[model samples]
Target chain A: MRIWDPSIETLDRVSLRQLQLTRLRETIDRAYHHVPCYRSKFDELGLGPGDFRNLEDLRRFPFTTKEDLRLNYPYGMFAVPMKEVVRIHSSSGTTGKPTVVGYTKKDLESWAQLVSRFMTAAGVTDEDIVHIAFGYGLFTGAFGLHYGAERIGASVIPMSSGNTDKQIMIMQDYRSSALVCTPSYALTIADRMEKTGIDPATLALKVGLFGAEPWSEEMRRELETRLGIVATDNYGLSEIMGPGVAGDCLERCGMHIAEDHFIAEIIDPETLESLPFGEWGELVLTTISKEALPMIRYRTRDITRLHPEPCRCGRTHVRMEKTRGRSDDMLIIKGVNVFPTQVEEILFQAEGCEPHYQLIVDRQDNVDSLTVEVEVNDQIFFDEMKLQRIFIQQLEKKLATGLGVGVRVKLVEPSSIPRFEGKATRVIDRRSR
Target chain B: MKVEQISIFIENKSGRLAEVSRVLGEAKVNIRALSLADTSDFGILRLIVDRTDEARKVLQAHNFTVNKTEVVAVEVPDRPAGLAEILQILDDVQINVEYMYAFVERCSGNAVIIFRFDNVDEAIAALLGRGVNVLKGEQVYEL
Candidate 1:
């Protein structure tokens, strides 16, 4: 397989470490000088950019958390001024308040390059037609893959999410070869195709790039077999740079991080102590080449280990395992990241709904289905059958649109859900892990 | 006039039907006519009950989703082509029947058919205009 940017992707260990150190120092100095959040953090740890003698010094610095971004709100953590920042993206905030991120013109250019490297490594080329199904708007998944696919000179069908039947028709008529979407959504499409009697093998799809939610090896096999494509996984978060952060090569090993732009570290979640290579722990990332919002040892709550050994595909960067689970209470159903608290918040927003709700996630026919059993108020108990059915449909639409995931809402009777005295058990994930 | 039918939402599990019966039996609410429509996950238990409000209240108290639906009871000839004659009237008037089930007992040698219609009032008017026997809520609950 051909490697993209071999000089950077397969750099020698000694030279790669030196480049990482230089970029790290530059990021620290930028964050400390311009962003007060990072300055205060560095001061709180009694450290400075000059204090970094080597890569190991990243441990002495205080870790930045998602709470910090929320506290900073919009643009408070940006290293550059708003005038210089040409693009902006914010989290979906399926919970409550969203975290905003900005990128300068240079940042966007660099982001596209990083993303292009991954698409190339996964065997996508100018001849391939990439169909991006990730939803557009404030979410970064679509735009990230869009720019990268364009950068590689590939024909892009920017068919952003939903419209399942139309998507299949375009995929067939346009003869698109690459599919970029969430793993769960890929399975959903495959299942829909089978139900419609559309032979997936007759399609021109050759490669699949899936991410944004945790998936299993079993799911990868299912997608590959049903979609007739070579499935690959990529990793990224909007708080950092999105989709280009890391991706798998043709070898189908772990995803290779773009070491030149970001530093990857794993730490034991309980003690916050850094763990050695090949050990399972929480993945921590630091943006070493960001121009707008350079993160300094940002804590990504995803739990996984890293393999630093050289990949068979000839890439020298560290590879992180597919995120198995989260140290926190985050549920990824049908490729949408959700928190149970978000479900409760939506439930409370709708009238005639009780505070009690149970989220049931089950995987059937290689796709994930989320069913929210919401307790209805006593007042709704006396509603006419027609009105009750309308109410249930309205609640279903509200939750699905709010969370950006198709949710099945069941109007259970009041007090049917068991009350909890302590930390409430809000989610019953039956997806078989 | 239309009859009040109690529809209970039930999970598809063993002993669930018996549990609904036990709850109603304890509450002394007699089920006059009943039918169940189910898929793999859940079932809808439709019943013509002697006491609509009481059955719904006791079922709700026992943590069952209960709703009162309006359905009409039509007495058809207890012979060949009886059900076909009723369907032909609905087809002629363009009145859609959502679902239908047979009552347990017969009235004057005629079979009682319970029907849920898209517009209960329109179906009742169309049935009565065609000289069809449209039973009232009180008579169907007793039968």
Candidate 2:
């Protein structure tokens, strides 16, 4: 029921569109005059900043991709000087070169404000103690949430990732009311609690804001029941202002996008054509209010839909559904597109299956095969070999039916699968290898 | 009639069995009787050790999936058809033997065999009803 900065959040559509148009023109001029990459892109289209008449004209500009950012490397995409830029953050660059982003002093202020909006919407108040588990480094997830919680005037414990036992101890000692980390890490905490016989009812946790990875609704239920906290989903990417791009209100519906700061669009990935509302497609965002990194229709590569209807919480901003998965992370097996979260949904429904699992895809004799390696715990382990075999057979059958493709299930010991402190890596595709 | 045994789940990779053995050996737990059942991917190493609790503790401390089970150990006559005669009695009573393995040492001049049955209590009663000698947990552990 609470709204942060209702003046901007509750603005009428007509006034919001007008504000976006004015900001879009300034962003275009800044990018075209300062950044060489944007200038060349504009030159190639023979278009100038003066040609923009309305919002529909944004589609004419060339879309920016992660590959383009990497091609420019560090500082090539910045629209301001180094002295004006106060802080710098970057992607992990696991695939290739890490794409660098810089933020000016004003940019940091806006970043905190944007994050504060979502934090308040998720039911955080100044009386709450926020415990952040995201790692602090070149990655933006931790710092993004850190400043946001500070902006809300709440007590913050910057307990950066790992040391699950210590994390639980501090959560109990500090009486943290707000938890910030990826959804998978929350499950890891729940697992450690079960192993140590720490009851969730004794903890003071109230709300959990999880992001940086795709998780299923079933996982939300699992976390809520196991941790005795209300779990909410938020969406953001390092390429665009990190954690505060959009978040859920107390209504527990889709996340409301910060349309006042950034413009969101959905387009078919293969054809690059715009799609209607309520249709699933790749997300494209353009930072209209950014001063340093003025992205023009940057391809987010995340797949989700948008709901234009007003939410019950009284915010008029359009809400975007939780992304199914990133376009790049989707696996193609036997010509069927599969997302890891879909596999997660099925595993959570099974009684004895743990939340920890890894999908290993390999090619043998020019055929693709998927092997889901699940962790074996006390509940799933059987002393009798016959019962064990029967349990595995039943799991394999369930997985095959749920996945629509035959899969082999391999059971490993508990804590065998590597637990991630940040974003969880759930897939290993060896077809290219 | 029901003897304590530890069953460990181990992957079928080289050095795994040796590692489990090294842990138990370093803990000074003597293996009285043991059997290994393996598939292509993993194996279950079942052991009746001189110290069941210590062996399970050491194996688990070394990160092996260890579980405790109760199995029936019987004293078999040392003749050629001695094992078959005891199994025939179990079969006549409709009690199924899941798995059976021979022990390393003899008990009172008879061959000792460890049997894991579907119904452990029923198999023990059937063997005892046929006048067969059944070893207790301490008798098998100290053999």
The candidate that achieves the highest TM-score relative to the unseen native structure: 1
Write down the lDDT of every candidate, Cα atoms only: 0.87, 0.85
Which digits, one per residue and each the tens of the lDDT, describe model 2 over residues B6-122?
Answer: 988877678988988899999999999999987787777899999999998888887777889999999999999999999999999898888889999999899999999999988
Model 2, span A69-134: residue lDDT tens: 878888899999989999898763323346699899988998999889999999998999999998
Query: Could you give the TM-score of chain B for each candidate, in order?
Result: 0.98, 0.97
Candidate 2: residue pairs that collide:
none
Give each prediction's DockQ, rounded to 2 decimals.
0.17, 0.23
DockQ of 1: 0.17
Docking class of 1: incorrect
**TM-score to true structure, per model:** 0.76, 0.61
Best by DockQ: 2
Which whole-number lDDT from 0 to 100 does residue A147 have in model 2? 95
Model 1 TM-score, 2 decimals? 0.76
